[model samples]
Structure formats: structure tokens, C-alpha cells
Target chain A: MSPQHRALATREAILRAAAEEFDRLGYDAAPLSAILERSGVTKGAFYFHFPSKEALASAIVQVQDDTWPRLTGQWRDRGLDPLRTLIGLFEEAVSLLSRDVVLRAGVRLAADRDVGYPGLSSAHLRWEKVLGDLLLAARDAGQLRPGVDPEAAARTLTSAALGARLISSATCRCADFPERMREVWRLVLPGLATDEWCPPALEVLAAPQEP
Target chain B: MSPQHRALATREAILRAAAEEFDRLGYDAAPLSAILERSGVTKGAFYFHFPSKEALASAIVQVQDDTWPRLTGQWRDRGLDPLRTLIGLFEEAVSLLSRDVVLRAGVRLAADRDVGYPGLSSAHLRWEKVLGDLLLAARDAGQLRPGVDPEAAARTLTSAALGARLISSATCRCADFPERMREVWRLVLPGLATDEWCPPALEVLAAPQEP
Candidate 1:
């Protein structure tokens, strides 16, 4: 492998190890020494990449953002109908959160630990704004129902999605978090759905029956 | 005041001050010296009431639980028909959260921090059972539709409520957390609602906008 490729691989390895440590022990209790030991990397290399644990946290948040399709790009590409994109994005998010433990942990931590962290908050707001702008764009297109507050509705939907994940992960015994999530979304999405799309048939999505 | 009254007053004062300090600075960062100053008590008295900060934290959680009406009583009273009651509880919780920053912070901290702390998880589970039992009762009464997993659904609702608080607090300015909570409950309740009531109608009961 090229020198650049080797460096990238080492960085990704450190981040994966850090994510596991942070998730298992939490942000405060997780120590750099433990991460170094787990990653099998020397202290010098870890410090070279991340000056502090908080900096490493920022890196993790960035990685999470990069892994998903950017909300802005996704919405904008939907041909001026942002609401369609917004729903699609949430559907995608539910899928990602259901399938990936790292994503779920990262999201929960984002809600809990990163509220006080500026870099994380900024990235979070940027994402929220992308959603907010989509709402605004939909409003401009006359797709939203009358009297809807674009920003407020957007935040409400965003918050509900986060809430769905929290519910599924902490409480559900079901193996796929997404399975539970779609049900929560069905209840949540109708209120936010634009006048253009007929409400998806409100079905009673249920748990798999035992043998 | 009598001597006994004075002593009791001092202890309560210390606990109130300790709660504020602990909530703001967390267990490790909150110094007893500051709490002592806030309560105007000597270190001897502070140590007399509480041996360590951990003890103080435990006391604070206990005091809050006593003061707060968790879902337990609500679930019991509305046992056979809990869909509306559970939704009503979230509505009440959201309004209460708006007025009390301490409660909001404390609850979120309890959810995140208590997993490692002894006794807390058990207490949390006990609360969960209260909610679970209510859901089971509702199922037997035909409130929850067929194929709805009572335990899983109850946990999902609880987790969503916690996550909603986190999101609301995290983005306090962008959204009114209380109102958004109503929106969340609106979505969650319908799936669990009986055939006669539609979800939006519950919103009118919980949060009727002025004419």
C-alpha cells in the first residue's frame, strides 16, 4: 500500500477503536490509554493524529456525517421538491441506524455528550439547517400545508427521528432497530407529510411471531 | 425555630444547593466547598449529611423521584386504557421540562449516567415494569391493536420520550421542545390507540391551539 493509504488505514483503525471505547465506557470514563492499547498503536501516533480525546470525538462525528449522504445534496437533488427528499432521507437514516451499531451509538452520544461540544453542535446545526432549508423550500413551492412553520416542523421531525432511535436501542429486544423504527416513523410522518403525497397506508407493522 | 427544626432546615438547604451544583457541574466537577458556601454550612455538617459526592448524587436522584410523578401512578390509574394516559404523561412531562431546567438535565443525566451506577438500573427497570404492566393491561383490554409487542412498545415510548428531551434541550432555540413533544406523542399514541380515536384528535385534547 502507498504511504498515504497506510496512514489512512491507521487513522481509520484508531477511530474504530476509539468509537468502541467511547460507546462502551462513555466519553468521560473512556481513556486515551485504553484506546491506544486497544488499537495497538503507540501513544505518539495517537497524539500526532488527535491532540485530545475531544478532538478525536470531533473526528468521529465527522466520519459519521461523511458516511451518510449529505442531507443538503440529497434534498437538492430531488428536483426542487424538498419534502420528498426529506422523507427519503429519514427513511435512509432509519435504515442506517437500524443496521449499524456504531451509527446508533454515535447518534445517541451526539444527542447526549455533543450538545456541549461546539464542533459537534455546529455540524449538528448544519444538518438541521439542511433539513430546515428543505422545509422552507417546500413551503416556497407551496407543497406544505398552510400555517406550517418550516423551521419548527423540520426540527420537530428531526427530533422525533432521534427519539425513535433512542426508543428502539434502549428498549426494544428486536434484533433490527430499523424494524421498530419504521413503525414509529409511520406514526410521526403523517403530520409532517406534505399535501402532495397521499399518506402511506397506515398499516399495523408488527413484530415477528414466535414459532 | 427549634434546634431540631434548625438542623432539618440546614440539611434540606444543603441538599437543594448540592442538587444545583451537581446538576450544573456533574458529580466529579461539583465541589463540596461550593455547595457548603451555597448552603452556608460547615464542611463538618456537609459531611454529616452526606459522606461523599456519590452519596449526594444518590440523594438528589431519590429526592427528584419522590417529587416527580413518574409514569407509574398514571399507568396504574389508567391501566386498562393507557394509550391516552401515556400520551398525556408525555405532554405533562414536556410542559414541566419547559419550566424546570434542573429536571430536564437530571433526567437526561440519569438515563445516560445511571447505567454504570449501582441501584439506578434496577430502579429504572422497576419504572419500566410499571409502564410494561400498563401496556399489557391495555392490550388485554383491546386498547393496543393485535401484533403490538407490549414490552417492546412500552420501551420504545420511554426511549422516545428521553430522546425527545435530549433533542429539545440540545436545540432549545430552534424549536419549542414542549410543543414538539406533543407532536411526537401524537405519532406514538395512534398505533396504540383504539379504533374509535384518530391520532390528530388526541392533539386537540393535549394541546388545543387558541382560536
Candidate 2:
């Protein structure tokens, strides 16, 4: 392999190691030495890639931020209704959280205040904005109930989703995330969507998806 | 003051100090020395009341556990409808969380996993049971809509409340806790309650109480 290709590979390996450590033992408790050992990379290579633990964590958050827009963009391109697209985005997020340790670590780190990563709240703020925009679109399309405020609904839904993920992580290691999210949408949709939109929204939530 | 009263006051002071430290620095970073300095109690006096940090945290959890039942019991004794009683309980919780630093600290510590406090999940489980029972009573009273599962609804509400508290704590130092919780109920009640019960539930949420 070319030198550049090898360099990229080494960086990726370090990020994976850091993510696993952070995921297992939180940001404060995760030791850099353990990450180096797990990656099987020399201390020199580790330093070349990540100067500090915070730097590694920040990189993980960046990757998470990058991944989200791409996933949502794909759903947006599908030309589905705004509400369906919002559900699709959550469905995608559940999959990513379950499949990607780096993403999960990023989320956990973001939720932790002691991490001191400004990027953490930025990520949440971004999601809230995305949800708000979608809800506005849904309202314009007559999919939303008459009295529902898009911004308030967006905040509640976002907070509820974050809360569900935290509970699932603590209680079941997220094995039940999809089911938990399904229940949240089940409880929330009737309140947010117009009567004509409720059946289809429920259908979207009930449709089978890969875990 | 009597000897018993003095001892109780000292114990309470120590718990308050520990909670402040824990709330500011998190569990792993909060040092016993900081708590000691803040409480102005000698090390010997501190140890006499609480043997260890974990022990202290456990005591805080115990205090929090004790507080909830008394608050809920007050509402239950009022002989209000179950749904109204539940709203009153949440309103009381909002006040306790805002007015009581120790309670806030206990909640933050309980949500934290690295604290290694076994009592944390127990606190949450106990709350879930309380909410479940209240929801079941509401269902029987015909307040809840048909096909709503009391256990699942209780879990969702509990998780949502936790999530809202976390968000409020992060965004506004919990200054917005009551407003955030009100928004949560405003969005959730419609889906959970029968149409006839919706206005009364909203009214209960909107009613102001002494904090």
C-alpha cells in the first residue's frame, strides 16, 4: 500500500480503539495507554494521529456529525413525506447507534457535561434544527395537527429520543432501542399528526427494519 | 440544640456539601477534601456521619427515595383523580429539584454510570413502579385512552422526564425545568388521555403552585 493509504489506515485504527475505550469506560476514565494497546500501534504512531484524549474524542464527534448529514440527506432524496422522512431519520439513527461503536461513543460523550466538548451540544442543536425544519414542512403539507407547534414538538421529540437512547443504553445495552423508539413514536404521533396522517405515520413506525 | 439535633444537622450539612461537589465536578472528579472544605466540618466528624463517598452518595439516594413517596402521598391523600394526582406529583418534583440542591445532585449522580452506585437504578425502578401504578389507576378510571398499555406508558413518561431534566440541567442550569416538563406533558397528554380528560389534564399541568 502507498504511504498515504497506510497513514489513513493507522488513523482509522486509532479512532476505532479510542471509540471502544470511551464507550466502555466513559471519557474521564478511558486511558490513552489502553487505547494504544488495543490498537496495537506504537506510542509514536498514536501521538502522530491524536495528540491527546480530548483530541481523539473530538475527532469521533466530527465523524458522527459527518455521518448524520449523509444519512439524512439520503432520506431527503427519497422524496418521502416530511413526517415519514423524519421517522426514517430516527430509524437510521437507531441503526447507526447499534452498529457503530464510534457513533455511540460520540453520543455518550456529547451527553456527558464533564467531557468539555463544545461540539457535543452543537450536534444536538443540529438535530433539533433538522427536526424542526421537518415538522414545519409537515405542517405546511397539512400532515400535522392544527394546534401543534413545530418548534416545541421538535424539542419534545428530540428530548424524548435522547432519553429513550439513554434508558436503553443503561437498561438493555440498546438491544431494545428500536422497540423503545417505536413506543415513543406510537405515543407521540397521535398528538402531533393530523387525524388523516396518523395511520400512515403509525405504519411507518411499525414497518420492519433491520436492527 | 440537643445532641441528637446537632448530629442530624451536621449530617445534613455533610450531605449537602457532597452533593454540591458531585453536581459541579461529577462523581469521579469530586474529592472528599473539597466536600470537607465546603461543609466546614472536621474529617472526624464527617467520617462519623458518613463512612465513604459511596456511602454518602447512597445516603443522598436514600433521601431522594424518601422524598418522593411523601410528596406523592400528599397528592394521593387529597383524593384527586389519578391523572390530576400524577400531575401534582410531577409539579412537586419540579419544585423539589429546583429548591433542593441535594436532590438535584442525587439525580445527576444516579444518572451517571461511572459513579458505580447500585442504588441508582433501584431509584429509577422504584419510580417506574410508582408511575405504573398511577397509570393503571388512571386507565381504570377511564382517563387513559383505550389500547394504552399502562406499563409502557409509565416507562415512556419516566424516561421522557429524565431526558427533559437532563436537557434543562444542561441548557439553563435547570431554570427551565418546569417549562420543559410542561411542554412534555402538553405533547404527551393528548396521546395518553381520552378526549374528555384532555382539558382537565392540561388544566392540572397549567395550575400554578408554590415552589
For every candidate, what is the interface RMSD in angstroms?
5.6, 4.3
Runs in model 2 lying further than 4 Å from the true structure: A1-14, A32-55, A77-79, A112-122, B1-14, B28-58, B73-79, B113-122
lDDT of 1 by residue, B1-211 (tens): 9989988888888877876665455566678789889988888888888898777777766654764555446544765346555555555556666665445435544643555421023334554565677678677767776667787666556545544555555556213666666655555555555666444447455566322
What level of docking quality does candidate 2 show?
A: acceptable
Top-scoring candidate (lDDT): 2
Best by DockQ: 2
Q: For candidate 1, give the docking quality class from DockQ.
A: acceptable
Model 1: per-residue Cα lDDT over A87-123, one tens digit each: 6665566666565546654654554454341112344
How far residue B167's Cα lies from its native spot in candidate 1, in Å, is 3.3
